[model samples]
Target chain A: MSPKVSQEHMEQRRAEILKAAEKVFIEYGYERATMKHIMDAANVSRGGLYQYFSNKEAMFETILEEGLSLELDETLEMLKENATSYWDMLMKTIFGEGGEPDDEMDPLAPAKLEFFIIGRNDEHRRAYGKTRYNNGLSIYAHIIEDGQRSGEFSKKFDHEIIARSIIAFIDGLAVEDAMLSREDLRIKEQSVLFVEYLKMALGISEHSTDGK
Target chain B: MSPKVSQEHMEQRRAEILKAAEKVFIEYGYERATMKHIMDAANVSRGGLYQYFSNKEAMFETILEEGLSLELDETLEMLKENATSYWDMLMKTIFGEGGEPDDEMDPLAPAKLEFFIIGRNDEHRRAYGKTRYNNGLSIYAHIIEDGQRSGEFSKKFDHEIIARSIIAFIDGLAVEDAMLSREDLRIKEQSVLFVEYLKMALGISEHSTDGK
Candidate 1:
């Protein structure tokens, strides 16, 4: 008789597979990347890979879901601890860990675009995309709401609308980044301009230098 | 003997083919759309279609180029003739002929997104996309510059950055529209809010009602 695998061990194995799959997706994009690539990348047998994910879409979806949830949890935890200013919280949430715009875009952006745009017609994908959009929307909305409550942000515009606009700007940049060169995108300039827009919309003073 | 076609007649025939091809692309999107579909839709022989456009990509590019140029020409003519207010010009240009936000979105948006995002890795396609992006960018930038010159828009922010943000918002919305239902997007509400953002950024008065 073989020894049984522990539940904790299974979870660890699943996490390892997801990390490998993400790298494959980033390199090959959504359409070209295949199960075989993931298998090789993860160094797992066919049965082991299949045991964790039924198909490529499932694996991709799991990666996105897990990453988003993890980020959201960390953000909420940060807020609970009052460890950062509202401005820094907003910037970091939108622009990544540095909380400042730069030339580098998320490497997974192209694959994410392909997955959602190409699978748009599929009922399952459409439903998944909707949930993902809402989850993304709420992350920004929650921050703006907190800022507004604390009088750090103006209530001139609805918090949800402001949040949605932020998502639109970021999503738009991702779409452009997928097609245009970094130089053409002028990512830093655009981000700085958008930061100005956010400041104007949120009533943050231009001279406020605390967050930087 | 085959009749010799006049140059004007040939141009008209090409225009008809492009119109039909546009319909086919909207129906099937970029990847699934085929040259045969365009041939059938345009009621042209295979040889005739080939004589005009070498491939589906060329045909699609021609359609986009023609559409954008036509719109640009019309806009420039209106500006030269001083036919409308700066605010009206900006609104009509961004939100279509109605000049107000509504539930409707561009029907060709998904196809356009697919074309740009999928072909991003191709050298020739990348070149075309960059030109198209710059052309699109200028439309908004020119209007904002005019507004600032006329003292209608503020000069606090760079006109180019604001213009870039507008393009980003529209492109981002198109991406979202491809995957989400119309209701989920809250199109009109988002547009109204964006208009407010624009007004604040440009220093347009909240009570200005002449353009509406």
Candidate 2:
């Protein structure tokens, strides 16, 4: 009889599979990737792959659902904890609030770009984007709504619309970071300037010192 | 004997095919669509379709390329002709410098939103996005570079970077408009608002007077 897998071992095994699956899926895309490809990438046999997950779709759902949700969740959490001013929070979240990675550049930029392509061309129903929006939009809309409620924001326009616009702006940047010519893409400072302008659009008062 | 089509008739036929292609593309996306689908949708026969274009890819390119160049040229013309301020130019160009379309509440929002997704999605290769963005980022970069050279704007940042950021903001709004709930999408007014923000971002002063 096979000994039961420990929880830690199970977690490691799952991560190993996900890492393997992500590369394969990204390289091959969803429809073209198969269990064999994933197994070969992971260096696991068919039985071992099935032991870890049910099938390709199941593997995909597991991969996508957790990866996307976690990336977004982490970003939102940073936004929540980093609120000295509105732009501070946005910059922190977007430019990586956790401090520089090993590369000292945005590691997420590549993945975020990948997400935009995947999000747009997934061939899935619109529900996927809608669902992610519902999770993120409500949180962000509430932030704007709360600011308005607290008299920190002007009532010049709809916060819901503002939140959606901001999200869209971020999405746009992510896609650009992925697809645009490296020479044509904005640097970190340029993106920060954009957030400054966005602060005005959302009717957020600029942080006193950042006006420079 | 077949009647010879006039110059105006040929132009009219091309426009009709593009319009039909746009509609079918919005419904069916590029991969699933065929030349036959566009030909049928345009109410033109096989020979008529072939006379106008080589293949579905060529037809798609014609529809997207010419449509955007026309839009960009028209926008630049309005910029050249419109009244005094940068803000007004942005508000007008982005929010219907064409002025409200006759016989419609508003269709440009959805129409543009559709085109933007098609432009930004990764499903299309770099070359296709390259041509589309030439009508977008390349044009905006030229304008910004001109603005900086003429002393109308600051040059503290890379003009191309800022231009792409501004485009990203607009593209973001378009992306959001396409992806969000209809009731929740950024409407024309919000789009106008973002364009206003864009003017400020580019160091253009706000318009004191309203367009409408």
Candidate 3:
């Protein structure tokens, strides 16, 4: 009889493969990066990789879904704690800690943009992209809604509108970051400047002393 | 003897080919798009097409350069006239007049993004992308600096920083716009909302009461 692979072992193997797939995707991008590359990078057989993900789209969806869910869970936990101020929490959620808005491009930045832009023409990919974008927007809008209810944020602008703006600003910066030099893009500095714009738009009375 | 084509006729034919190339690029995107597609769309022989442009890159560069120059000249003329409010002129320059922010995706949006993101991996393309980005940034930055100097806009934030943020926001919105439905993205309304954010950041005192 063949040895039964435990569920935990399968999960571990899946995670390991995903880590490798991420690397492959980042290096070669969506269109050019093939399953052969993933197999080589992950050190998995064709049968093994196929068992986990039928194709590149499935693999990419799983990767993005996993990353987003993890992020959402963390943000949700932060919301429940309610220890941090709304603005601080929002900034942390968006930019993360110890992020200095420097010139270092997210290694996966090119892949991420390539995936969506190329996906534009594909119906299946477009549907997945839309669902993912809406999911992200909801998380952000919820934070703003919470702030407004607590009177920490101004009621001047719609929470959903403000939330979408955040997405736009970040995405726009990423587009520029992908194309321009760090010196020219000045992402970190631009992000700092964007935070100030956020403060004004959200009608936050005072600026946080942190994030500098 | 072969008939001589005048320089004007040659220039006109080149322009015609570019227009068709734009359509082909929009349909197939940058990577998948082929010179044959452009030739078929333009109804020119491959030889004829090659006479004007050595490759897809040269064709794309010519198209983009023409667009930018036309836009820059119009904007410079606006600055000279100085009739419009700085904010209005900036918005017009960035979004264009009569742009309704509807669901009609910029047909070129995907190709434009694909070109730059893929360019991230190619050194020659990367260098060209950076130069193009800086040129665009300077146009916007110049508008803001002019505003600050003229006392038409407040200097609350660095003009360059503000300019970069505008690029970031627009690019970010385009990223989302390319992926999501117009209704889901809320681009038109969000753009109007973002103008409010811009006002707050720039310290523009009164709302324009336009673009409603």
Cα deviation of A176, candidate 2, in Å: 2.0
Best candidate according to DockQ:
3
lDDT of 1 by residue, A1-212 (tens): 33355777888999999999999998888888899999999999999999999999999999888888887787666656654777778987887667788877888998999999988888999888888888888888988999999988888888998888888888899999988888778778888878877888888886663654
**Model 3 C-alpha lDDT per residue in residues A92-180, reported as the tens digit of each score:** 67875432344555666667888888878789888877877777788789889998999888888889988988888778877887777
Which residue pairs in model 3 clash with each other? A101-A188, A171-B172, A172-B171, A172-B172
Error of 2 at A125 (Å): 3.0
Residue-wise C-alpha lDDT for candidate 2, range A1-212, written one tens digit per residue:
33455767778987998899888876665545689999999999898888889987677667767866787888777777766654455445445664321113333434433333334545563566667677777766776777677666676777776776667666776555545565655445555665566567556654543545
Candidate 2 vs 3: which has more DockQ: 3
RMSD to true structure for each model, in Å: 3.2, 5.2, 3.3
Global fold similarity of model 1 (TM-score): 0.87
What lDDT score goes with residue A59 in model 1?
95
In lDDT terms, how accurate is model 3?
0.79
How is the predicted docking of candidate 3 categorized under the CAPRI scheme? medium
Each candidate's fnat, in order?
A: 0.78, 0.45, 0.97
Cα lDDT over the full model 2: 0.62
Give the clashing residue pairs of candidate 1, or none. none
DockQ, candidate 1, vs. native dimer: 0.71
lDDT: worst 10-residue window of model 2 chain B = B100-109
Model 2: which docking level applies?
acceptable
